[model samples]
Target: MSALLRAEGVGKAYTLRGKRVDILRDVDLAVRGGEVTALVGHSGSGKTTLLHILGLLTPPDSGRVFVADTDTSGLADGALADLRRTRLGFVFQSYNLLPQHSALRNVVLPYTGRGADGERHARALLDRVGLAERAHHLPSELSGGEQQRVALARALINDPPVVLADEPTGNLDTRSEETLLGLFRELADEGRAVLLVTHNPAVSEAADRVHRLDAGALVAEGSAA
Candidate 1:
């Protein structure tokens, strides 16, 4: 399969108290359709920075990023936002669900333009994540795992080709983590490219390939399975 996402020589830096702090440098990465690529690293190791760049949440100081054959280097803010909304999915560690919305409503938020079928699609995604019975529950009423599942369903509601997950199972129990990993595998099987940033070895084990980062650079790439 061809690459669904690609990043070449990407770099990001931030200024802290008049000092330059480099987050990532010369990073080259790619994710093909139907693959799960795990980025593993310790805290403060630029994993999240790399993920943010890959997801287009933050632009790199220098480098080229392409998603689904579109080069994003010179896109304006509005155009980039449109690309992100239409072609990408995100799952964060915090779940990030709206407290006021039910599980189904949270998933439907991404499909507002789909008219009447949004709710039905949301319900189906919830069922896929094993949360059909909890569809009406609010984020606060659900377990951490259930909340994460809702978030995952919301991420997929758009049916984007690429999913970027940042520490997605960081707060879940072992069993919950296992369930989420299974869902991720299913997504990959359906030809979605998954790039996940995780510190957990168990999570990395589920990936087909693992890339390790340290001190603002990719240090190792190997098979996790």
Candidate 2:
């Protein structure tokens, strides 16, 4: 499979109290369609920073990021925003749902210009995630797993080819984590490029490929299954 999101020799650093602190160094990786790629590391290892770069939320200080064949280094803020909205899906550990909105409404929020069938499509996605019956429930009324599933549905609202998830199973119980693990695999089966940053061993262990990072650099990588 080819990469939908590719990072090559990427590096990032931040200044703290007049001292440069590197967060990533000469990193190289790809998140390809039809696979679940897990990035694992301890806290402060820069896994989330790398994910942010790949997701176009942050720019690398060195090297390049490619969305499909498009080199992102030269794109302006507007172009980058367009690409991010149209080409990528994101899931977060906090679920990121609007507190007052119904699950159906939250799922449909990103489908700008929804036209006549937006709610229908959103309903279908909710059903796909096994939440059809709870479509009208507020985030406060749902379980953590349910809210995350709703976030997953929302992420798909734009029909993005690439999915980026940061610590997706971080807050779930074992059973819920397993359920999400299965869903991630099914996402691969449906041909979306799935890149997830996770600390949970179970989450990484279930992935098709695993990459390990240490002190902001890739230390090891291999097939996990």
Candidate number with greatest lDDT: 2
Single out the weakest 10-residue window by summed lDDT for candidate 1.
Answer: 109-118
Tens-digit per-residue lDDT, 23-120, candidate 1: 99899998888889999988999999888888888999999999978999989999888878778999999999999999999999878365778888
Candidate lDDT scores, in order, read: 0.91, 0.93
Off by over 4 Å in 2: none
TM-score of each: 0.97, 0.98
Question: In model 1, how large is the Cα lDDT of residue 71?
Answer: 92
Candidate 1 segments exceeding 4 Å error: none
